[model samples]
Target chain A: MAKSKKNPLRWVRLDNAAKIYPAAMRKNWSNIYRQSMTLYEEIDTVVLKSALEVTVKRFPSIAARLRRGAFWFYLQQVEAAPEIQEEKSHPLCYMSEKEMSKYAFRVIAYRNRIAVEFFHSLTDGTGALIFLKNLVAEYLEQKHNISIPFEQGIIDRRVPPKSEELEDSFLKYAGRVPASRRDTNAWRVPGEKEPEGFIHVTCFKADVDSAIALAHKYGCTLTVFFSAVMMQALMNYQKELNPNTAKHKPIKLLIPINLRTLFKSETLRNFAMFTVPEIDARLGEYSFEEICKAVYHKMGYELTQKHMSAVIAKNVNDEKNILLRLVPLPLKNIVMKAVFDRSGERKSCLSMSNLGVVRLPEIMQKYVSRVDFILGVQATAPYNCGFLSYNGKVYINLTRNIRDAGLERHFFEILRDMGLEVTVESNRN
Target chain B: MYCVKCGVKLEDTEKICPLCETEVYHPIVKQEQVPPNYPPDKRPPAKKKTKIINGVVLFLIFIPLLTSLISDLQPDGAINWFGYVAGALTLAYIAFGLPMWFKRPNPAIFVPCFFAATVAYLKYIDFVTDGDWFLSFAFPAAMYFCLIISTLATLLFYLKRGKLYIWGGFVIALGFFFPLIELLLSLTFDLRFIGWSAYPFVVFGLLGGVLIYLAANRFARDAVQRRLFF
Candidate 1:
C-alpha cells in the first residue's frame, strides 16, 4: 500500500526466511530466480510497464526495496515500479547489492517473453509466480482488450492490499521446540567457472504424461523422481572425478517444499523450506530404484507438519534471540554470512525446485504459449535445477555458471533412457 | 533433430548439443533460421566502480601527507619529521591503495611489493636516524621476514591444492624462525635473552604438527571438518 503524507514512508522487517539473503549476498552474486511467460505475440514494453505499475500496487511486499537499519535489514515500499528492462544477455544476471537497495525485483521483456527476476529476499517461487501471473493478466487485458478472470493467482488490482498477505508466516506458525540444525555437508560439484559471470540456461521440454508415468512406475511424485535422477547424475559425476570409492561424500539434493500446502497461511512472502534427501555414496552404489525410494521416504519424513514446524521454530527462534537482535547490522551480516556458508549451500550438492504445475484462468491461457521457472545457481555451488509443468509439457531448466555439461547430459540421458523423449533448448551458443 | 550422443531432441537454433558438445547434423533436414530463446545482445553485468573509490582513497591519503608536509616545512626550511610520516604513508599506500587499482590483484605480485616497501621504510628510518643497527639488525630482519612471507604468498597463490600443507609448513618454519629472530636481536641490540622464543616455538610446533597430520589423514580431516563446519 502507498504511504500517506502523514506516514511519509512505510517499511516492514524482512521475513524470518528472508533475513539470510541480504547478509549472504555478495558484490556480484544475489539469490535470484526467474518466472517467465512467453506469449503468442511480441511483448510491448509500454503496455508491460503500465501493467507492472498496476500490478505492483496489489502486492506491497513484492514492490518494496531492501534497506539497512541499525540492527537488521528491512523493506521499504517504493512508490513507482522498477523500469521494465529489455532482456539483453541472460536471465538472472547478477543483481548487485546497490541495485537490491533500490529495487528487489526487475521486469524483463524479450521478444514474445515477459520475465520477472526477483531477489530471494522478496518472495519465493510461489509468491513470485502469483505476481507474474497477475502482471501478465494485466498486460494481456491492456494490450489485447481481453477481460481476464480474477481467479487462479490473478489478483484484482481494485482491492486494497491486505495485511495478512504481508504477514511473516514463519513467526505466526513457529513451534516451541526447535529442530536440530546438524547436517552432514554434501559433496560439492566442481567445474571451470566462466570468468565473465555468464549464466547458461538449458531447458528440457518433456511430455507431462510421460514424466508422470515414470514417477508413478517408481511409486514417487515427480519432484522425487527428478531429485533421484539428479542425485544419480551427481553420483556418476563424482565417481568419474574421484575413482576412490571410500572418499566419496554423500550425494544430496536440496528440494524446496512449498509450506503453503501444509500450513494455513496465505502470505505472499517466502514460505518455503528445504528437504535434503541424500544417498551416501561412501556406503555403496545405489540403483535408480533405491535412490528414488530413499528420496521419497526422506522427503515424506521431513515434509510433515510437525517436522516443518520444528524447522520453522528453529529459524524464528534465532530471530527472537535477544543477543543476536542487539548485534548491529554490520556485525550481524558477518555472523549470518558465516552461518550461511557453513550450513546453507554446503549441506547440499544442488537444489531442485519444482513449482508442481502452474494453472491460469481460461481467458489468459490462450495468449500464453509457454511458462518457465528458473532458479539461479547457488553462490558457491555451480549448478541448480528448476522446472514446472504448464500445459501438457514440463519445462525442466538446468542452470549452471560452470563450463562443464556433464550433469545436464547425465540427467537428460537418464530421462531419455527411461523411454521419455526430451527436447532440449539452451541459451549457450 | 536429436543429439546423436545424448539421444535428446535439439532446437533449431542449436548448432551443437550443449550437453555433449556433439555437432548437430541431419541427412536431409536443413537448419532453419530461427530466433533463439534469449536475445543476441550480450550485456554482461556492470563491474563495480573501483576507480572512484580508488580516487577517493587517493585523496584521503593525500590529505594527511599534505598536512604533514605543510606543517613540517612551515616549522623549518628543511624536512625533519615529515620523512617518518611520509615513509609510513607511502608504505600504507603501496600495501593497500596500489592493489585496489587492479580488478583481481595478483597476491603473488602485491605481497612481494608490500614486503619490499616495509624493508625500504625500515631502511629509510635507519638512514634518517644515522643508526648503527641498520646493517646488522633492520636489514637482515626485514629481509628474512620478506623472504618467508613472499614464499608463502607465491605458493598459496599459484598452487590450488595442498593449502593445508603449505600453511602447516609455514607455521613450522615460523616456529624455527622465531628463535633465529631472538638470536639476531641478542646479537644486534646486546640484550639478554630470557628464552621467550622457545615457548612460542613449542606451541607453534604442536599446532603445525596437527595441521600436517590433518592434511595427511583424510579421516581426521573429515572429522575435523564436520566438527568445525569449515
Candidate 2:
C-alpha cells in the first residue's frame, strides 16, 4: 500500500532514549564524535518551482525538525567554540559559514577522520541523509524564490508544525533478532575481539558523468562495484597475512545503507543501520561484476520490508534495556553493558559509508576545490572508508587506528582492471 | 589527551601507563575533576620510604596465598575445600571490599556481589563437606546470600551504568555458579565425578578474573582521565 499520508515523512524525539549517548552534549562535541558524520550540500539556484518542491513544502514541519540536532545544529548556530586544548594541535571541525552566499542552502562537510574513535556509539547513516535532504530543501524555500508546484498534486503543502510526530516509523522495526549463524565457532572469532588495522588508499575521482553507464557496463552502481572491489582487496590483504587459512577465510566488509527512503523520518539524531556483507576468499577472488552482483543481491535482500522489519526490531529491542532507564548510574551500567554486547552484533570487518551522488548548487560549485568525508577507525577493525560525491566526482577517505594504511592500492587496482579510469589522492599527514 | 592520568608524556609507550592504571598519585588539587593523567594531588612526603613499606606489606600477604596454592594439592585431607574457600573469599572481597573503600561509590554495584558470592561459596563448601545437613539449612543460607548479591549487584549496576551493570553482575554470578552448582549437586548425590568435569570451574574463574580486571582497569583509567576522583 502507498503510505497513508502524502507527507509520509515523520520524526519523533524519544524522551526516554534521549538522555543516553550524552557524549553529544559534552565538550568537543561534533556529530562525528558519535561517529555521526554527514555532508550538507547547497545549490544556489534561481528558484524553479518544481514537482519536488511541491512534495517538500507539504513537509516543512518535517524539514525543519530534521535540522534540530547534531551537524545541522552546529551548522545553524555557528557559535560553538572549539574545545580542543591549546597544548594540542588536533584537527578539529570548527564551525564554518564561509560558504553561505546568495544561496538557498548551506553545505557543511563533516569528516570523521579520527583514527581511534569508531564503535564509540551508533548512528545510522539514513538519519544523516534525511537531514541533508531536508537542509537543502529548507534552504531552497527560505533563501531563494522557490515555491511548491501544488498544481501537480505532488504533496500537500499543508503540514502544520503541531501535526508532526518526532518519533520515526521505523522504530517498530527495532529489537534483537535471532542470529542467522549460531555459535561463535561458526562465527569463527571464539570471543576474540581482536584489534585490526587497514592499509588505507583512495580511488580519488572517477568519471561521474558516465558513472551509471560504467556501472551498467560493469553491472553495478559506483557503490556496489567499488565495494565489491574493496571486498576482494581485503581478501587479498588477509591472504598476504594468513596464507595457510586462505581458502575458508571469510573477508567481511561493513556496508552502510542510508535509511532515509526506507524510513521516512525528518528527525536526524541517528537513523541508519548497516549490513555486514562477507565473501569467502574464493568468492572474493571472483570477477568484479560477480562480486558486485553478489553484493547487490545481498543488500537487496536486507533492505526489503521483511528484512528491514526484522533488523530494525532486533537493533532497537536488543538495546532496549529499560532497567538502565530506571536504575542509578552506578548500578545501571551492568544492564547497559548487556545491552551493548547484545546490540553489538558485528556484521563485517570494516565500515563502508557511501554517500552516493552529493548534490551541489550552481554558484559555489566553482571555487570549491573538492570535498571529502572521513570515518573514524574503530575497535571492530583498523579502518573504515567514508566517500562523498561532489562536483561530479567522488572522494574516498579512510581512517585507521593502526599506523600503516593499505586499502588504497588494492581498491584502485580492482577498479582499473574492471574497465574504468579513476584518479588517486592521499592525505599523507 | 594530555597526561590526564599522571602528567606523564603520552605516546606509543604510554598507551595506558601503570601509575595511571593504579592511580596512587595525584599532583594538582583541583575542584570536581582533574585531568586524567595527573596523579594524586599530593604524593607522600617520602616516596622510597612509602614504596618499601608497601612492598613489605604486599610480600607478607602474598606468601601465604602462594604457600596454600603450592602446599595443598588435595593433600592432608579427604577434600581440599580450602581452595574453594580461598577463591570464594577473594571474589567476595573484590566484589564487596573494593567498592566499600569509598563511602560513595562512582558505580556502586561492586559491594553486594562480594557478600553474595561469599555466602554462596560458604554454603557450597559446607553442603559438599557435611553431607548430613545439606538442604535442611545450607541451601537456604547459600541461596539467601545469592539473592542478596544478585539483587544488590543488579540494583547498583542499574543505577550506575543502567543495563550494563546488570549484565555484568549476571555474567559474574553465572561464571561463579558453574562450579558451585555442579560441586553442590555432585556432593549431595555422592556421584563419582572426575577432575575433567571440574575443568569448567577453571574457565569460570578465568572469565571472572578477566571481567573484574578489565572493569577495574577501565574504570580506574576512566576515572583518572575524567579527573572525577583521586
What are the per-model numbers of colliding residue pairs?
0, 79
TM-score of chain A of each: 0.98, 0.61
Q: Kindly state the number of residue pairs that clash in model 2.
A: 79
- Which ranges of candidate 2 are over 4 A from the true structure? A1-165, A172-203, A246-248, A282-285, A319-327, A330-346, A361-369, B1-230
Pairs of residues clashing in candidate 1: none
Q: Model 1 over residues B149-191: C-alpha lDDT tens digits?
A: 8888889888979998989988888888788788888988898
- Give the best candidate by DockQ: 1
- Top candidate (TM-score): 1
- Model 1 / residue A167 / CA error / Å: 0.6
Q: Supply the DockQ value of model 2.
A: 0.01
Give the 10-residue window scoring lowest on summed lDDT in candidate 2 chain A. A112-121
lDDT of 2 at A52: 29
**Against the true structure, what is every candidate's RMSD?**
12.6, 21.5
